[model samples]
Target: MSINWDDLKVALAIVRHGTLSAAARALGTTQPTVSRRLDALERSLQAKLFDREAGGLRPTALVLALVGGLEQMDAGAFSIQRQVAARDTGLSGEILVTSLDWLGDDVIAPMLARFGAAHPGVQIELINGTRVFNLARGEADLAFRFGSFEQENLIERRVGEVAYALYASTEYLQQHGTPDVGDGFEGHRLVYLDRAAGEVPHEAWLPALARHARIVLRSNGLRAHMAAVRDGVAMAVLPCLLADREPRLRRVALPHPAPVRWVRVGFHSDMRDTPRIRALVDHVVGEFELLGACLNPKQ
Candidate 1:
């Protein structure tokens, strides 16, 4: 019997995730179905593809040998799918773009508005939230993200970098005095991001700075954190793109250089070349290039 591509795909997913349940979740199937397909594939090939281990399922040498070819096939299949999608001549359709909430005010909002005016046929749905929207599952057509992305079967381009700095309202600074370099946050109250929305690399460094200071408020949203800081509730580490422009706030110079995060634009590989997706990606990249200096100011 010929090898079934469907069964091979299941095996690939299992190998990638290291568990039947996780593979099922990625494949949108049940664990039982994944197990059945994996068993069938092993039987057809007459080879033990994986060894169940205490930690997780480990692929055998033979299975490892097959993975490289499978990945190449996956890429080719995705390329063909994208080519087919690109065949749609008409550009009129709804394309969703997901980004952090702060960008809605000054950064992406204007670029999206200009895109709308230029291409009135294509509808743009801008989703602003604290979490990164899933691009592979169609939750968003495109995403503006920070840090390194490692998900397979997706494409990303680095658009720019985001710089972060300690910021406080003028009233708070005047009342408590600014934190000098290497002061260990003495007598400071911090308004910080909650753990739920604390995946950014810079957020991890905040605990060290606020180790001595008291955490007065923790928020999952940048807008809330900004509001707290602006209201003179507490000091916060904020993005330069947002805080630098505010006249009421001041950037506290730290002994160390402020953290910088890479801004990446990501989308599913299968939709990379689609007309609407391509247009959005190109426009956003150009917009970032135009505002790169502001987004990533020299520290």
Candidate 2:
């Protein structure tokens, strides 16, 4: 009897996540489908594979016995898939990339346009959001991100650094006369990211600025914050790559410079040799190299 790999994948997901709904979510299907597949797989094998428990489904001895072998099979299958992709010298396939919303419009869009022009056959799906797409779950093929890399067993490279600085409209700077370091922002109207946005690590520089400055507005995105600054509503801390070119904005010379964070590109290590992924990674590295000075002006 031949075992179906797709059914085995469903079984593996159930074992990994411990519930039909969770398995269905992981596999991008419905709970009823997972249940039907599990039932069918058990009937084909003529054995009970799991015991429904209060906590969740517990794998029976039969399923436990199959886990190790199935995991190895899964890894082998992934390796083979990667090998096939690597062998495709024609470099034709869809590549999904995850990027922050702020970079989606100006920075990554232009670079991706250039990459798309060269690889006319390859399609790209760019997911731009505040949420981090899960690479381990096959959510995205490539990512352009800020700060540090956390996921293990992925190929990660620091492309550049993004420097954050306080900026105000030239009209506001002229009217407010650019608050001095000694004055400590007492008279300044500051626009900043909302603390409730749960961006504490990224906003570590803001507390000090907020202590003395009057927080006039709070926004969840850089674009909104920058717009507030441009409208003469308040001064804002913004990424230099985006704010520097805005002729209406001027950088404030503070006693201490703004914080700079590293920007990184990462993908699953297994896909390192995959032709399209490697080409995109190399293109991203080259794009960063060309604009490294602008991204990390201080360095």
Candidate 3:
């Protein structure tokens, strides 16, 4: 059976927002219009997509099963629109790319400069943050993610690998001496990523330096933590890609270099063939190849 796009959009919006009024607000329409469209959609499908409960309209199993297909269809429609726009304007459009803040600065920024130089007509918008951007929800057109992803109907390529190492300021190293497995870490303060503190990995890894080391400072930002190290606030474990580039920092000891993590560039499978997206992927892959030694050092 043929489904109207508008009705499908309304139905999906309602399911997402949990209430007709919220969906209406999202769609910039009245609650009655949203309710009417959802009713029409249910009538056309001859299925109950949601159940009215005390909490709100809860999506049924049928809705969950169908939502994936509907989302795929929506992605396809957007791909078509993007293709048409690119064709009409000759690749002169904006592409949104998301990545971790430090990676964006240390890795993606240079590649973006080269890409921009080559494709002057194309505009690139980079969103750098610690939060993972939802590609399925169209939060970003492309993402450079670290670690593994198992999302279906998406294209993921292992672009590179990153290694972490313990680092400290030259001044701190001189004052406190190098820490080893038996060293009394309690003698020196520790700097850690605020997001990683109390995390099992961090707890297991950092404490390996010493049994009684205290975390004196924590920051949610890699750059900030590295800066703290440079400023002689405390020593921190940092990605080698960033540490190796800093002039004032020195590698202290292996202590607990977390396992290397894979860096992946991901995009919707349908968008893989788009010229602009393909060009970007190729450029990033090439850039990583050129800089792999720096990002994933032998040590």
Which structure among the candidates has the greatest TM-score? 2
For residues 17-77, write the lDDT of model 2, one tens digit per residue: 9999999998899999999999989988888999988888999988998899999987777
Question: In what order do the candidates fall by lDDT, top score first?
Answer: 2, 1, 3
lDDT for model 3 comes to: 0.77
Q: Alpha-carbon error at 132 in model 2, in Å?
A: 4.1
Error of 2 at 207 (Å): 3.4
10 residues in a row with least lDDT, candidate 3? 195-204
Best by lDDT: 2
lDDT tens string, model 1, 176-286?
898754667788888877867646676677777657888988887788888988999899889898888899998876766788877788888778668877887788778
- The TM-score of predicted model 3 comes to 0.72
Instruction: List RMSD in Å for every model shown.
Output: 6.1, 3.4, 4.9
lDDT of 3 by residue, 260-281 (tens): 6667998766576667787888
Report clash pairs, candidate 2: none
Clashes of each: 0, 0, 1
> Which whole-number lDDT from 0 to 100 does residue 2 have in model 1?
79
